[model samples]
Target: MRLPILLLTLALPLLSQGQTADDIVKRYLDKIDGSKKWKDVKSMITKGEYDYGGIVFPFTTYAKAPSQYKFVVPFNGKYYAQGYDGNSGWKIDAFKNETTPTLLNGSQARAMANEADVELEIPFINYKAKGHQIKLEGRDTLDGKQFYIITLLKSGGEKETYYFHSTTYSLYLKKSIAKNIELEKALLDT
Candidate 1:
């Protein structure tokens, strides 16, 4: 009897943690954009700079719903581009001397297609339906600032961890590892 009661007390916190994780994600999403508006998102275009080994290159990304995407980077007066046009994937790399648009195949094509698919929707919105899982990993400090740590396991086995502001509930940092690629993004303006 006492053993069972002790077990229940221990399990309660564990169970509540999952619920709390879900609630935190919901609040973050609502703060970014309501669920209804998230679903209505059809396309997005983002222009930014990619820094590689101290070299900064301007890049543009275009994505559309139903799986369409294009990424372009201009260098040395030449354009390097990758795109998935709903059905097929293609690329043009000036450094590789592939001036003509080359149709991507095999893993390359699949990777580009996957990017388009994910670009259509923001993760954490209907994460369960998307076959992903999220968990609250307690609190942590980043850059001398306190934050709530949340980790997301994507359906494809990728892992992503997010840091939300302890008080604002806004996402402050995100780190992800997918297919041998690791990326860390800071959302200071977000």
Candidate 2:
């Protein structure tokens, strides 16, 4: 009897550990402030400036609920457009910027579809149901700030690591190796 009781005590932490990860993600979604409003928002336009290595580039992300998106990025003085229009994904010329529109299918289109989710949901929500996997990789300090390292493995086989504020649970950074995109945009208005 005493041995069984002792075992339960030891197992409690492991049980709660799984829940803590879910709690962290839920709190994060609450902190950001959206849900029903996001559902009602048929379209959203996020305007902001992206700066890298001391250079600032103005950009905008437009999204429609469920999965429609269009974003423009400036490169070498011209703007490049990319988006998924519900039916299919497309990309404009990078050199001429707007001279041509090309169809995007397969992995590239799938990536765009993932990004095109206008709700901007907390990835952990229904993650398992969607066939995705998430792992909370403990906590640590980065650049003098504390953060929780969460790794997200998408159903599509893409993997991303996200750093969230340890206390606030707000996402501070996201890195996707497959996409080769490392974005830190909390300070930017997006």
Count: clashes, candidate 1: 0
- State residue 23's C-alpha deviation in candidate 2, in Å: 3.5
lDDT of 2: 0.69
14-103: candidate 1 lDDT, tens digit per residue: 774554788888888878885778777888886666555456667677888888888787889887888889899888888788878898
Return the top candidate by lDDT: 1
RMSD of candidate 2 to the true fold? 8.1
lDDT (10s digit) by residue, model 2, range 57-164:
666788877788887877676876788888888887565636788888787777677667665555565678888888888877888998878878988786777788
lDDT of 1: 0.74
Question: Residue 54 error for model 2, in Å?
Answer: 15
